[model samples]
Target chain A: MSTADNPIAVLVELRDGAVARPTLEALTLARSLGTPVAVWLGTEPDADAVAQLGEFGAAEVRVAAIGAEARYPAKAGAAIAAATEDASLLLVVSTFLNKEIVTRLAVTTGAGVVVDAAGVEFVDGEVEAFQTVFAATWNVRTRIAGKAIVGVRPNTTTASAAEAPGAASIVPISVQLPATRETVTAVEPVAQIEGVPLAEAPVVVSGGRGTGGDYALVTELAELLGGAVGASRDATDEGWISHEHMVGQTGTTVTPALYVACGISGAVHHRGGMQASGTIVAINMDPDAPIFEICDFGVVGSLFDVLPQAIEAVKAHRGA
Target chain B: MRILVTVKFTPDLQSQRSFTDGTVTRTADDGSMNELDENAVEAALQLVEAAGEGEVYALTVGGADAVAAVRKALQLGANHAIHVNDDAVAGSDVFGTAAVLAAAIRKVHDENPLDLVITGMAALDGLTSMLPTALAAELDWSQLTLASSLEVGDGNATIVRHLPDAHETVTAPLPAVVSVTDELNKPRYPNFKLIMAARKAEVMQWSLADLGVDAASVGAGASRTTVVDASPRPPRAHQQIVTDTGNGGNALAAFLIEKGLA
Candidate 1:
C-alpha cells in the first residue's frame, strides 16, 4: 500500500492553456498508483488549468518554465528529477517529445524507464508494467528494479471524471541545463484533417488492399462515427492513403475500443498492431479471410454494397 | 567527414513470431536489415554523396546472423561494416545494448573521429526508439531524432522531424546523433554488382572484451527489468460470420447496437 508521502507525478502537456487528452489519461492512471501530482512544463497553472487537473484528481500542480534556450531534454529531466524527488513513480505520455525527456532522465539517474506501457499497476508494493511486444503476439509483464519512470500509451483507457476535485498547490523548481548544440529552426504543422487523430480516437475504421484503391466508404463511415480513418500497409503502399494512416507492425499501434476492419485481410503483420483493441469488427468479400478469425462480428460481402447500407443504418439508428 | 549509421537485423514481420523463455526467437524467421534503417542508410548515403567527400560506416550488434544487417548496409553503399558480437551480449536489454554500442562508437571515434551518427527511428523488433538518445547521452553529444529530412552545413546537422501533427526542424552541431524516420527518403534497391560485392565485403568483428564491456553488467541477469511472465495470446473464439444476403449491413448494425457501440 502506498502512503500519503509517496506521490505519483503525472506529466501534463499543455497547448493553448488546455491540458491534452493523453495527460488527462495519465492523471487517471496516476491516481490509481498514489496521490496524483500534475507536472506542467510550459507555464504556471492558472485557475482554469488547476480546475482541469483537479477534475482528474491531481493533488498538486508543479510548474517549471525556463527560458527558451534552456528548455531541452536535459533541463526537462533535471526539473522532473528535482520536483519528483520523493515521488514513488513518474508517468509520462508516450510521445516522441516525452520519450526524449524520459530517456535523458533514465540515463542521468540510472532509473529504469518503460516505454509504451499499456497498463500500470502496483502489485505487491511494487510497480508492474504491462508491455505488448513482438507485434502484440506476446504480452510481457515487467517490473523495474529501482526508481520507475513509465511512458503510458495514449488512449489505453477511457478518461473518466472523478466525483471529487483535487486541491491544487503550486510547487516551483529551477534547473540549469547544459548548453545544447541542437536547436529547432522551423515547424510545419500537418494539414488539418476532418477527424480526430488516429492515436486518440476511440473508434477506428480501417481499410486495406480489398478496398480496390477507393476509401470513399471507409472515410464516410469514419466521419459519421466521428472517429479516425486508418489503412493497412497495402493500402498505404498503393498510395490510396498516407503512410500515417497505416496500422501494422511497421506503422502505428492502435488499441481503440472499437476497431472496424473494412475490406482488410488480417495478416500477422497487420494484426500485431491492432490485436489489442477492445472489440474488432471485420467486413470482407472473402469469408475465409483471416480477419474473420479474430473479429467479434464478420460480414462476408463486397464492401461497396455493405458499407453504404451500414452507414445508413448507423446514421438512422443514431438519429432515433 | 566521417559518418556512422546503425542498423539492425530483425525478424521478417510477415513470418510467424515465437519466443523462447523470455526472449524473442529471431532465427525462426528470415532476417534482414530493419526496414526503417534502410531509410537511415539512404539518408547517410545522400548526405555523403552530396558533400562529395566522406565515408559512411555501418555498425550492428547481435548474434552471428546479425552481420547480415551490415552487409545489407554495404550493399546499400556504406563504405565500412562493423559487427560487434559475443555470447555474453545475448539477451541484452535496451540499456545494455546502448552501453555496448556506445563503447564501439567511442572506439571508432578514437580511430577516425566521426562527425555524425545516424540511425533509424526504431528497430522493428523492439520498437523502443531509445537507442539514439541513449547513445547521445553516453557520448555527451547533441541529438536530433525522428528527422524526416536532413542537411549538413557549417559543421552542423539540420533535420526536419516529421511528427504526426507537425514538422519540426532542429539543428545540432558536429559529432551529434540523428535518427531518421521512413518519411525521409525512399530507400534504393541494391544493384546486382553491389549485391555480389557486398557478399565479399570485409566485416570487422569485435566482442565485449574488445570494447571493454563487462560481462556482468550486460545480458539478461544484469538487466534492470525482467519479463516476469509471457503467454500465447488467446485465440478469438465463436466468431459470428454473416454472409450478405442483402441484409448483412442490418445484422452488423444490430450487433453493434447490442454491443452498445452505436
Candidate 2:
C-alpha cells in the first residue's frame, strides 16, 4: 500500500555509461509526485552519474546490478520490480524496449501502465496521465486505479536541477531473474545520423517528394539549425533516406520546438505525427499544399530556391 | 506447422475517431483490420506456405463487427478464422485483453498443439505495442517481437529485429510468440478467388464461457486504468502564409530569429 509520501522510482537509462537525458527529464517529473528514487538497471554508476541524479532531486539511487543480462528486457524488468518494492509509481523513458520492460513490470506487480504520456499529475491521490492520441488530434487523460507505471515520452519535460542537491545514497539490490527461451544470436550496430536524435531533437527539418531524391539541402538546413534531418514516407520509400529518418504515422512522431517541412505536402498521416509541434514552417512549390494549413509560417516557393537563401540569411544573421 | 495470427479491428486511420463512455466508439462501417496486422498476416501466410504442410488460423477478439478482421485475413489466404466475442470482453485494458487472448489460445492449443502465435508489432489504433509481450507472459511462451525479418526452420524461429539502437538477430524454439513489423514484407492483396470465398466463409465464434475466461477478470471492471477525460485538441492559432519572391528565405530566417528558435 502506497501513501502520498511513498517514493517514486524513476528508471534511469544509461547511454555511454552516463544517465540519459530523458531519464533526467523523468526524474524531474517524478519529483513533484513523490520523493524521487533513481533506479539504475545495470552495473554501478560512476560518481558523476550519481551526482547528476542527485542534482535532479533523486534522494537515493537503487542500483540493480543485472549487468550483461540487462539486454534482455524481462531480466531488467524483474530487477526494477525487485528494486522498487517501496515505490508508489514507476517512471520510465518511453522507448520501444522500455515499453516492453514496463509491461512486464506492470504484469508482475499488477500495476496500471500508460505509455507515451506527455505529462502526468496526481489528482486526489491517484495518478492521471495525459497523452495525445490518433496522431495528436485528441488529448486523453487516463487515471490509474492502483499502483502506477508511466512511460513518459522524451523531451516532454524540461530537465532542471533541484534547488538543493539530494542525498543520492547508493543502495544495491539483488533480483532473481527468470530464465527465457529467446536468445539474442547477434547484434549489429547501425550508424546513427549526426546531430540530435529525431525524437528528442528540439528542431526538426523534414523533406518530402519535392526533394527529388536529394537530401543535401535538407541536411544543410538542419545542420545550420542544430536539428535533426527527417524525411516523409514518400522520400524514404523512394530510397532517398533511411527508414529511421522517416516521420509520419508509421514512423517517428516528433514534438519539437520548431518543425520545418520543405517540399512536403502534408498528408493527414504526416500531420498526425507532428501537428503538436510548437511552431511549424513549410516551404512548398504548390500554393495549396496541406502543410500550409497547420503551419504558423508558410512560403509558397521552391525549397531549392528558398532553403539556400534561408541558409545564407541565417548565416548572415549569426555573423552579424 | 500450425500457426495462429492475432488481428485487431480498428478505426481506419483516416476516420474521425472518438471515445464514448471512456471507450473507443466502434461502428461496423468505420472499422476494418488494423493496417499493421496485415504484415503479421502476411508473415504467417509466408511461413505456412514455405512449410508446404501447415494451416494458418486468424483470430480476433472484439465485438460482433470485429469479425471483419478475421474475414480480411481469410481473404489473404488463411485457412481458418476465429472470432472470440462476448459483451463482457468490452472495455478490457491490455492486461485483461491479454488474459482473454491467452485463454482462447489455450483452448485452440489444446485441440491441436500450435507451433507459433504471431501478431503485429502494434495495433495502429492503440499503438501500445504491449499486447504481444503481455500475451507471451500469460502463456509463458518465448516472445520475439518487432521482427523486421523472420524465418522458421529445424524446429526454431529466427528473427532480425531492427531497433533504434541496434539490429539484433534473435532465435527461439518452436511454440513461440512473434510480432512482426511492416518492414518484414509487403502484404499481398487478396485474390479474386479468396475474396469471393472469404465473403461466404463461416467464422468460428466463441464466448468467454467457451474459452473458460471469467467475465469478472476481463472487462471494464477488471481494467486498471480508466479514461478520465478526452477531447479534441484546439486548432493552431496565428496563421501566416507568404508567397516567396527571392526574399522568402530572409523572411523565414527573420521569423526564426524572432522566435529565438534559430
Candidate 3:
C-alpha cells in the first residue's frame, strides 16, 4: 500500500549458497502483493539463482556490482534504491548484514519495514505481517501503508518447491562504495549441525540435554516424523548434541508448523528462538521444565517413555 | 583506526514475553548486549589493540535503559560511549535508526576522521538484520558481512567470509563498514577493572535536536509498518502422559504399539 503509485518490486538479496531458502521464500511471499525482482549483490550471480529466482516468482533479477568484499548493507541499500526506482515495496531477507541495507534503504526510499516476519498476509488490501517477538511470547500482526520494506527470516514462506528459468540482468547502482571503517581479518566456518535448518524445515523433532548423550530416541522420532532434528544448547554444549542443532538465543530461530521439544529445560533464550512454532509439544520428566510451560502440548514424562508412542502415532497417521 | 562500534540494548534472549493485542510488550529486565553485538565490541577492541594508535568509540540509539549497553561496550575496550537519545528515534524502522546513526557517523567522521565502522551482523531483537548494509550505503563505505577471519596489514584488511562448506577471502581498502557475523570470534567478557572503568567514563547523550532531526520522522508515527495487533501464540496443549516400567527397551516397544507404531 505504498503512497506512491507503483507496483512493489520485491528486492530479494540472494547470495551464492546460504541465501537460497530465504530468496525462494521471499519470492513466494512477493507474489501476493508485488512483482518480485530478485537482486543479487556481487559479480554475476551463480548460474543456479537465475531460474530459481524466477521460478520462485521473481519477474526480474537485478544485479548490483560492488567490491567482492562489500558487505550486504551497502550493496543491498543501493539495490533497494535501484530496484525501487520503478517499484514501491522492497522485500529483503532478514540477516545481520542486510539489516542496515534495509534500514538505509528505507531512509533513502522513504519507506518502512516489517522485520523477521513469521507469517505475512495481504489483509484488507494492506500488507499484514505476523512477527514473532519476546522469545515467541507474543505474535504481533502488523501492517504498513505507503512505501515500505519487509525483512523476513529465511524459510518462513513455503515456495512451490519448483524452479523456473530466470533471466538476470545487471543494474548498475549510481552510488559509489562508502569508505569502510571496519576491517575484517577472516571468517571461520562453524561446524554445521546435521539435518535441515529449523527455519527451512516443515517438521522438526528436538531434544534437550535430558537425552543424556543418547540421541537415539530423538533421531528415531525425527526420522519417523520425516523431519529434521534439533537440540537445546545445553545438549550441544554438553556435547550430547552439536551446536548445529541447538535452538536457543545464540542459535537459529525456528518458525515451523510442528516443533517437538524432548527433555529440554526450556530456557527463555531457547524459547525465544522456537516460540514462533505453530504447534509446540514438549516431553520431559519434570512437568515443571520451562519448555512445557510454553508448549502447545505438554507431556510430563521422560522422553525415553513417550517418543516411541508418538513416533508410532505419527507413523500410523502417515500410513507409513 | 578511530573505530565506531554500534551496539543495541536488547531484551534478554532468555526472557519470557507476551504481547498485548497488536503490541509487543517487554519488561525492564532486558538482558545483555546481544551476543553478536558483543562480538562486534570484541572485534572493535581487538582492532584497537592491533592498530596501537586508534581510539574505539561505542555508538548507540536508545532510551536511558540502553545506557547499560553502551557502558558494556565501553568496558569491552571502547574509549568513549555516545548515546543518541531522542524520543523521535524510538520506533525507528531500521531506516530511521540508520538515518540517525548515519548522522552520528557523519558527526564522528567530522570530529575524528573514522577509519572503520563496526557492528554485529544483527542484534538478538532479531529484526531484518539489515542495519549495517544501510549504514554502509548512506556513508558510501566499503563493507563486509559474515567475516569469519580478519587481518589488518599495510593499511588494508583481508577477511574471510564463511560460506557453506567453504570460505571466500576478500580484501578491503581502509575505512570500511563491516557487519561481522558471530563466527568471526567469541566476544570476551568484561573484567571488573573494565566495568569500573566504564562507570568512571562519561557516556555522551544527544537528542533528536542534537542530531538535527525532526521529531515527526522517527518512531511508529512516521513508520510505514505498524503493529496492527499482538496475541500470545496460544498456550501449549496438555500432553498425553506415557510411562515405562523401568524396562525401557520393552516399554518402548509396547509404547510404540499402543500408539499404533508397531
Candidate 4:
C-alpha cells in the first residue's frame, strides 16, 4: 500500500444499530473525493448500517483493522490506513477519544490532521476545510495540502439522499493492537433530552432568551410540526431549557431542513450554529432581533399569544 | 499510577482575537490553555487522582507566559512540570508542536514511560486539534477522543467519547492516546504550593532544528491549513431590542401584528 492512491477515507462512528448523522454528512463530503471509503471499526458493519450509508453516497465501507476493545481508539486509524492504503486524506468525526487514533494514523501515515471542521469540500480540485470557531463567533476556512486528516463538526451539511452502493466487503487487517494499562467493561447511553438529536431531526424548533421559560408555545408548535425542540445558549444557561437542548458555539450545531426560532434574540454565536438551516422562521416581540436577520420567514408576536393559534391552525390543517 | 499531561500556549479563544500588524495582541486575556487541552490535562489528573498514589506531570510548549498555563496544570495538581520553550520553536503549528512535545515526551518517558498520553481533543485556537493525533502518530500510539469520561485500569484506557449527540464508551490498549472533552470533568484549581513550585521549575525549550523537523513543514510553510480570509461577521442589521414590561403581552401582540405574526 502506497500513498499514490490518495483516495479520501471517512472513519465511521456508528453505535447501536444507527449511523451518526455526522457520519452521513462526512460521507456526503466524501463524495467529492475520487472514491470515498469508510473504515468501520469496533462494532461489526451490518446490512442496515451499510444501507443507510449507501443512501449517503459512500463509494466503499471497509471493516476496521482491530476488534472491539476496552480501551482502543486506534482501530479506526489502523483500519483507515489498512483499508484506504493509498488515501491522501482521512476524515473522522471529532470525539474526545478518536483524536488520538487519528493523530496516531496521521503520524503512522505522516498525514496532517485538522479537527472540528464546520464544512469540508473539494475547492478548485483541492480539499478545503472550514471550522466554526471562537464560540461560533467566526468561520475560519483552511486546507493542508499533500496529506491531511480532518475531524468535521456536526450538521454543517445535510447528507445527500443520493445512493451509492459502497463496497460492503469486510476485511480484517492484520495488525498488533496496542496494550492498554486501563479498561472499561461496560457502557450505556446517556439520558437523552425530550427532543431528539437536533442534527438528525429534519425539523428543529428552537427558542432563545425571548421565550421567557415559556416552552409551552414552542412545544405546541414543535409538536404541530412533528419536530424536535432546541434552545439558544442563553435560554439553556438561563434554565429555560436543558444544556443538552442548547444549540450554539459550545453546544450542538444543527442544519436541519427547517428551523424555527421563537423569542430568540439571536446572538451571532447562536446564529453561527443554525444559520445553515434551510428554512428559518422566527417569532419574537422585537422586529429587529438578530434572529430576524437570518430567518427566511418570521412572525413578530408574543409567543404566548401567537403559539396557540398557530398550533390550532396546524392541527386544523392536519384535521385532528 | 503516574500520568503525564501536555498543554500548549495559544491565543486566547474567548477573547476577541484580532491580528494587529501580523502579531497577536495581549489585550485579549488568557482563556483556558484550550478547552480540549484543558480536557486532556483534566483527564490525566483525574486518572492520577483516582489511583490515589500516582503522580501527574503537565508540560507546555511556549514562551514564559506558557508557564502560566503550565502553572495552571500544576495548580490543578500536576505532580511534575516540563516547559518546552525556545525561539527556534516559535510559530510551530501542530506538526512542529508535535515534534517539540515528542522530544519532551521522550525525555519524560526515559524517566518513566507513561502508560497514557492525554491531550485535549483539540486546541480551540488551532481549531485543528491535530496535536494529540499528530503526537500519537509520531509515537505510533493508540488513541481515543471526544472523551466525556475516561477510566484507566488493567493497563488500558476506556472512555465515553461523544459522537454526534450520543456518547459511546470505548476502550483502547495502553501506550494509547486520550484526548478529552470539557464535559469530562471540571478542572480543579491549583493550590498555592503547586503554583509556586511551577514558578520555580524550569521549562525545557527546543529550537525547530533540534526537534529534527523541517522548517518548511512547520510555522507558515509546514502548516497545511491557512486562513485565506478572516473577517468579523458583519453585525446583524435587524437588532430588535424589545423590553418586556409586565403588561407588554398586549404590546408584544401589537408588535407581532406589526411584523405580521399576529
The Cα local distance difference test for each model comes to 0.83, 0.90, 0.68, 0.65
* Residues B30-147, model 3: lDDT tens digits: 6656667888888888888877788888888887777878888877778989999776666666667777898888888987788788888777665456677667666777766666
Better of 3 and 4 by TM-score: 3
Instruction: Residues A26-137, candidate 4: write the lDDT tens digits.
Output: 8888776655666677656678887776666665566653555513545445556776666767888775455667765666676656677766766776667776555444
What does candidate 3's lDDT look like per residue over A1-320, in tens digits?
A: 12323354655554334355766777787776755666666666665667666666666666666655445444456555764677656676665445556666665666767777766666666777777676766667778786666778766777764344345344545445544444434445555546665556777788877898898988997776567888887787788765567776556777777777888878876887787776676777875677766765566667776777656655665575
Which candidate should be chosen as best, given DockQ against the real structure? 2
Please say which candidate is ahead in DockQ: 2 or 3: 2
Q: Quantify how close model 4 is to the true structure by its C-alpha RMSD in Å.
A: 5.9
In candidate 4 chain A, where is summed lDDT lowest over 10 consecutive residues?
Answer: A164-173
Candidate 2: where are CA atoms >4 Å away? A1-5
Off by over 4 Å in 3: A1-87, A90-108, A122-125, A152-197, A212-216, A235-244, A285-287, A299-320, B13-32, B50-53, B75-77, B163-166, B214-221, B237-262
Decreasing TM-score order of the candidates: 2, 1, 3, 4
Q: Judged by lDDT, which candidate is best? A: 2
Error of 1 at A251 (Å): 4.4
Which residue pairs does candidate 2 place in steric collision?
Answer: none
Name the best candidate (by TM-score): 2
Query: Against the true structure, what is model 4's DockQ?
Result: 0.24
Please write out the lDDT profile of model 1 over residues B1-262, one tens digit for every residue.
6899989988887776667777777772488888889999998888888889999999999998899899999998998999998898887777888888889999999988998899999888888898888889888888989887788889888888766666788888888898988778899999889899999989999999999989899888787777777777776666789999998888888888888887
Query: Model 1 compared with the native: what TM-score?
Result: 0.93
- CA shift at A143, candidate 1, in angstroms? 1.0
